[model samples]
Target: MRENDGKSIIIRRSRGWIPINWRDLYEYRELLYFLTWRDLKVKYKQTLLGAAWAVLQPLFMMFMFTIFFGRMAKVPSDGVPYPIFSYSGLILWTYFAGALSMSSNSLVGGSHLISKIYFPRLLMPTASTLAGLVDYLIALGVMVFLMIWYHFPPSPGLLVLPLVVFCGFLAATGVGLWLSAMNVEYRDIRFVIPFLIQLWLFATPVIYPVTMLPEKYRWLLALNPMSGVIEAHRACILGHKPIDWISLEISFAIILLIFITGLYYFKRMEKTFADVI
Candidate 1:
């Protein structure tokens, strides 16, 4: 027993938390990879179409918007082809929506692991968000094909695409962290998430061009972080003129603020997870 106790102490101290021990997170990278892979597998497992569902969703949405908005409502598409324009935004929006949904429910979804394991709780939601990126990449392939079909060449500004995508991830993860933490405490948050995402979809520029908004309202619209990301994506992909830099900067700041606050709140609530959950 004495020898066993000494060995256990050595093991515990060797793996003990260091201040800002994000290195441990890196050390646990394999676990994170497996968790992310598990989510991807579970997402498509036993489904008939499998990963093709990613391409189908935005494609179907584009068809509906083309008929309803472009044909009947006569909504503008910033002088770009309607189908390509909407599909670009929809692809990104779909990833955002999917990440938000998965991350928000990650804690509850992994309740069994939380009850049994001692890994970083943050990994659950982060892995859930990361898993959706695979679908985003698959959907992006269709977006590229649509661009070619519409005779739109990729813009030089497309080089900035990665930064724009990071912003989208930040915005989604920021809100998702808050939702996931709150959800662990209040079951109502789970019900509200779908409704919130639905409302957020229309609020975003997925179906309509931001240019259609009055100039005065454009500033207010930029308060939503997705506004900057969507507009940046259009500017990059469709060779649109430069976006309003001020609005993009403001949106970036807001997203950062939300991310910081959400992380803080999540940490505060994390202590109670094993207890309450």
Candidate 2:
């Protein structure tokens, strides 16, 4: 073997705990790209409908919410057209749900690769989360078309949409990292994740406006980071008003907390992945 190969093999077999070499991840960026592309292609390959599933999901949900919540329950939509208001929230929420679901199972799904390979285990979940962005963009195109059809012009605040989306990603990734790592040891988290996400969706302001909550409870509601994100999406698209800075700040803080905590937990469990998985 070459000298560098010998050195790498020695390092891999060394005794004490090793710090996660993040620079190695950057060096392997090409692998990350390939993994992400593979997931994207596999998601649509051999499917009759292909990308249509993306547009269909949020569109169908928006219709149901408009029918039941807008018409039946008489839920307020902050004075914007109910379909547009709900569709915007659904677009963001769907991305979060899809990413969370895929990522939580990513390590288990890639067990073959993990057991046989030396790449960063974190890449598995990261690729899954990144792949969900394709669906988000496809679904977002439908939302844009709906906006034009409804005669709603895009607002200047829409410039911040990317930041809002990033926050959603961070939140998803944070929770996903923890779940993916733990799932390697205990498979029960897999079954529990769906139920948790369902509860999370209702807790969020997806079907109804945040204004429907009593003023006294608004601060309490902001404890769920998604509440702030959904409200920001609506405010940006509908121009109903500026974002609630206080809520946004609280949500941002929580995202950071989850991110740091998740990273630590993921790294802590990473070494045992090959053994458990």
Candidate 3:
């Protein structure tokens, strides 16, 4: 209970199937900012390379992928240079993967805070995903450098890059909500997250183009939301072809489904977090 003036406010656990209290979240917006900033500080603290690890992680992966997938396997990049092609996709993938991983573990990692505090539990994972944007922006600098070296000029499609990125963020946040809530109950979730990320990386089109698959099989890849996000990034940044509206529409629907369902699930699980954790 908190005291305001001479009055006391009573805090009660939410009843069954309640919708998210957007007002409550808004009221606690400063807490969200604090958590996000704390995550950023904690992420880079005591690291020898500090923020440079963000650039080097994706950059080195791009090099290996360029050699193995681009050179050895002769992967098609829609005529864009393989390095920039792979790097562009990698930057977003790196962000999504990091966001998903961090958020999945957020609740368990913050167990002490969860047990002691009255803040919105959703803020934990939300801040985890939001903090990754710093790393995302840092990695994008390497992409810009690669684009310049490869002589690939930005296209008008760049206008929609933010939307594509939001889609990726939505996917990460949605999955994080589901996994983080479950992780509170099942400790094994932490073990599964790394394997899940590895599989999801291959499922996404980070190292190859969707066109590499036959037309009939292309729909399969489109079913994965990250495919559309990555392909749209290539369209916007590489200017290979016009954006694929149909695929993007499908991806948006799936991402929306995941987000809405994840929200309900997280809220349903929220009441039990303190007890379970």
Candidate 4:
């Protein structure tokens, strides 16, 4: 901390419109933790299945995909079984999907806290995204059991799983920012989220491997950030091939773009949140 003439100088705005204070976020890290914990507990509070629901959402989706796509349509999995292939990717997808959807609504959901408190507004959605990691890890545990049941050895490329997951986090957080800010002013944004995710799932290589698509169409898949994330997950988990560095790079680039632009827009609109909501 520094002071000029005993009056602390605070950064007033980012560039011109966006407002960001990294120091404030660091100072309030405990609030972030409490908010994340609250979200996790609230999610499982009234449910009989409790944490098991986290494992089951992706697990059952895998079962349906296996029965339909694997058995009936004969979907290709790049030399791996469709169930484990889909399950591995689903572990990540389920988390991103939940986090994005929840984060989009978080600001509105926490309107009471937002109106009363002076905490960093970004913390709301960021906490929601981090909270979903619990479900993601539970589903990942199920994935490990599935791998053993299918006798699939860990891929050497599994070393890169952390990188892939980080990309998904960035993408989810980025989209969450934009959506949450928009949702405050325009409530219909919430209705669009479910439909958006449905279309997005088909766009990503979840039930089928990237190789299952035509060569020309494959190029378009990279435009969907999750496409690369899911593809990298499959590659690293099943040893499909060396990591698709090109797609992974493209995904990272998009994640960065989304994060920057989303943060900017969210901050730009943040001044209107209390008044508008």
Candidate 5:
């Protein structure tokens, strides 16, 4: 606790809202990598299919959608093959859903770590979210295969894929932080997550094209952050022309708002996690 020349070894705590310290996170960056790797290992460890499960989930979902939505419901696919069209959205959606599921439970799931050590709790959800990238890549490979099978050539629009993926990550991580923080006190939150995901799935444009929606009601779809991500994915991956910037802008604005508010909520509640969780 000794201080000399206006320097202190320990930064004193304050009652005021704690904003994220990028320096602290950077200093502990190695830990973030470690946690992320740990998640990857634990996820696939002792599994029959191992990492293939990543590809399978989305691949199988794409199959079902190709049958049900493409054939039975006659959903429009923006001129791309229904399988590839749905696969594009499924890949991104699966990653978002998986990350959200894992991250929303990460804090309580790792109760032992929180009780035993001192580190940024924020890193837990972040690690859980990022760990799903492995799954995303595996599923993306499936999408590539589908594209090749369907003779869908690659497009220059693929350049924006990274931005679309970033939006998905932001949206997932933001919601994950909020849920994980709340799950500490409300165990029932875990029960509701599945239903919430199902509802969110229908709300996003994964199974259908955004053009199917009337112009006036497009605003409602834009409110979902993944709407833009999924829409951009379909356009870029399927070589569809002209992304909907309006949707992307709306999604981006919402994600920023969610991320900032979620971070604040997580920080304000994190101090109590160790005790309650």
Candidate 6:
């Protein structure tokens, strides 16, 4: 409270779902920075492998998929080699899996701050999601090496790689917000996230080409947002096929719907966090 001419003035946060205080986010930007940095440090603090885990996680998965799916099952990669094909998909998939896992647990993990302070609860999940970008960049470097080793040259479509990554970010952040808010009250969401990620991976064409499915059934893939994002990544990075705009549009629509609803749900639930936590 500030005293002015013997009167006190009070400021309050707008509680409505649509009216967010953007100024508050801007003011707390430094706190977001600290939270992101802290998350990165804490994630690798005691690990013997440290940051190498980022590269190893996806790289090892690529090897396993290449051996089983590429060699045994003879999974088609739309003419792209199996190892690079799977590794490219794994780069984005790993980031999304990590982002979704960390962000969903962020609120419960930071319960101490929630009970003791008045900062935007959204920052907890946002920081958690952003911190995984460090791992994404590291894994992406390995992808570059694979592309060179395989003598694959990127097409002009490669320029759209950022858009594909952003779509994945939106999908992860949307699901993260919903799960984190619900996890604050229920606490069971933590267990469900791993299962959800595993199911989602098979639903997406990460290990195989979407073309293996009949064209009549291909429409169902559009319902899965990562399907378009991962497919777009292959088209851009591998340059074997044109980007699937129709599927991508549908995916974007679904992602936007999820993101907006998640924001509203998160805001609605945050009011109870300090007390419940």
lDDT of 1 by residue, 49-141 (tens): 999998999899989999999889999998887888888888889999999989999998788888888887778888888898899999988
For model 6, the superposed segments whose C-alpha errors exceed 4 Å read: 1-18
lDDT winner, 5 or 6: 6
Worst 10 residues of 5 by lDDT: 1-10
lDDT (Cα, tens digit) per residue for candidate 4, span 1-277: 4565544755544356655878778889999999999999999898898999999899889899999999999998878888888898888999999999999999999998888878889999999999998888778887788888999888889889888888888899999999999999999999999999999999998888787788988889989988988888878987868888999999899999999999999998887788788
Cα TM-score per model: 0.91, 0.93, 0.95, 0.94, 0.95, 0.94
Is 1 or 2 the stronger prediction by TM-score?
Answer: 2
| lDDT for position 236 in model 2 | 79
Write down the TM-score for model 3: 0.95
lDDT value, residue 20 of candidate 5: 81
Q: Which parts of model 3 have CA positions greater than 4 angstroms off?
A: 1-13
lDDT of 5 by residue, 1-277 (tens): 4556433446566586886877778878999999999999988889999999999999899889989999999999888778888888999999999999999999989999998898889999999999998889888887777778878788988898888888889999999999999999899989989999999999999999888999999889877888987898778777776888777888899998998899999999988888888
The digit string of per-residue lDDT tens for model 3 on 67-143 reads 99999999998888898889989999999999999999999999999999899899999999999989998998877
lDDT of each: 0.84, 0.87, 0.90, 0.89, 0.89, 0.90
**Rank order (by lDDT, best first):** 6, 3, 4, 5, 2, 1
List model 6 lDDT by residue over 1-277, tens digit each. Answer: 3565534535666466645658778879999999999999999998999999999999999999999999999999889899999998999999999999999999999999999999988899989988998999899888888888999886899899888988988989999999999998998888999999999999999999998999999989999988999888878888888998888888999998999899999988888899887
Model 2, 141-189: lDDT tens digits are 8878988988888889888888888888888888899999989999999
lDDT, candidate 1, equals 0.84
* lDDT computed for candidate 2: 0.87
Predictions: Cα RMSD each: 4.0, 2.5, 2.4, 2.2, 1.9, 2.6
What local lDDT score does residue 58 receive in model 1, on the 0 to 100 scale?
A: 88
Error in Å for residue 274 of model 1: 0.9
